[model samples]
Target: MIAVVQRVYEASVKVDGEIIGSIGNGLLVFLCVENRDTDDKVTYMSEKILNLRIFEDNNGKMSKSLQDINGDMLIISQFTLAGDCSKGRRPDFTEAAKPDAAKETYNKFIEDVSSKINGNTAIGIFGADMKVSLINDGPVTMIIKR
Candidate 1:
């Protein structure tokens, strides 16, 4: 599994001109499931994301986790994280999980995050054509893979 985590003041996802999910003062996570991903990956990623000390402390140090700040999360499925562009001009997604498996793992990942964050999370529809908008906070972004 791979995730691009971005700290955001606010974020939202829209599908067919309708808002599907949104969050405030939290993280916007673009998650991808690879063919080799498992439940352990989901567990580890959730814990790591929730406990990541990206938020600033009172002294202006980046020392507070999302849980410490009571922040929300907006999770979006993005299989392109597994895309391989090493060859030719086009990217290949052969390493990404099949639709069914990817969807299952993605859902499980969201469930795990929700469980850890006390349900303060929203998710975009799996395999949907989504439009995501965000006010990135501190421009802080990190990518994690497992």
Candidate 2:
């Protein structure tokens, strides 16, 4: 599993001009599932992100975790994160998990996050064409894999 987490003031996902998921003052998680991933990877990725210290603390330091700040999360599925560009002008999706398997992996990851964050996690449709928008806070972004 792989995640591209961004600290955001707000974020939302739209499908067919209808808002499906949204979050505020939290992290926007762009996730990808690879052919080699398992539930263990989901567990590790979930824990790592929830405890990641990207937000600022009262002391003006980047020391607050999502759980510490009671923040929300917006998750989006993006298999393209696993794209391979080493040999061609067009990126290859060979490393990405097959859709059905990837969707299940994505669901499991979301479930893990939901349990820890008290169901404050919002998610885009697994295989839908989504339009994502966000106001990136500090422009802070991280790519994590397990």
Candidate 3:
């Protein structure tokens, strides 16, 4: 599993000109599931993104977690995150899980995060051609993998 997490002041996802998911003042998560990914990886990534201390506190230090700030989260399925470019100019996606399997893992991750955060978690549709927009807070982004 791999996740590109960005702290954002606001974020939204659109599919075919219709807004599917959006969030305010939280994290935007672009996730990918590799062939080897399991439910455990989903759980770990969800927890890590939620608990990361990347939000600013009263002292202007990045000391607050999503729970601490009562922030929101937008999760998007991004199979391209598994693109392999080591060999040539054209990226390869053989490492990425098949759509059927990847959607299952993506749904599991959304379920896990929703169970933890309740109403604050939003998600993009799996396998959709999604257009995502965000204002990255502090441009604070992290690439997490397992």
Error of 1 at 85 (Å): 0.9
RMSD (Å) per prediction? 0.8, 0.9, 1.0
Which of candidates 2 and 3 reaches a greater TM-score? 2
lDDT of 1 by residue, 1-146 (tens): 99999999999999999999999998999999999999999999999999999999989999999999999999999999999999999999999999999999999998888878943799899999999999999999999998
Q: Provide the lDDT at 34 for model 2.
A: 99
Q: What residue pairs clash in candidate 3, if any at all?
A: none
Ranking by lDDT: 1, 2, 3
Error of 2 at 124 (Å): 0.3
Query: Which TM-score value belongs to model 1?
Result: 0.98
Error of 1 at 57 (Å): 0.5
Q: Estimate each model's TM-score.
A: 0.98, 0.97, 0.97
What's the TM for model 2?
A: 0.97
Sorted by TM-score, highest first, which candidate order results? 1, 2, 3
- The segments of candidate 2 whose C-alpha lies over 4 angstroms from its true place after superposition are none
Question: Which digits, one per residue and each the tens of the lDDT, describe model 3 over residues 84-130?
Answer: 99998999999999999999999999989998873388889898899
- Tens-place lDDT per residue, model 2, 12-131, is 999999999999989999999999999999999999999999989988799999999999999999999999899869999999999999999999999999989933789999989999
State in Å the error of residue 139, model 3.
0.9
The ten-residue window of minimal lDDT in model 2 covers 112-121
The 0-to-1 C-alpha lDDT of every candidate, in the order given, reads: 0.94, 0.93, 0.92
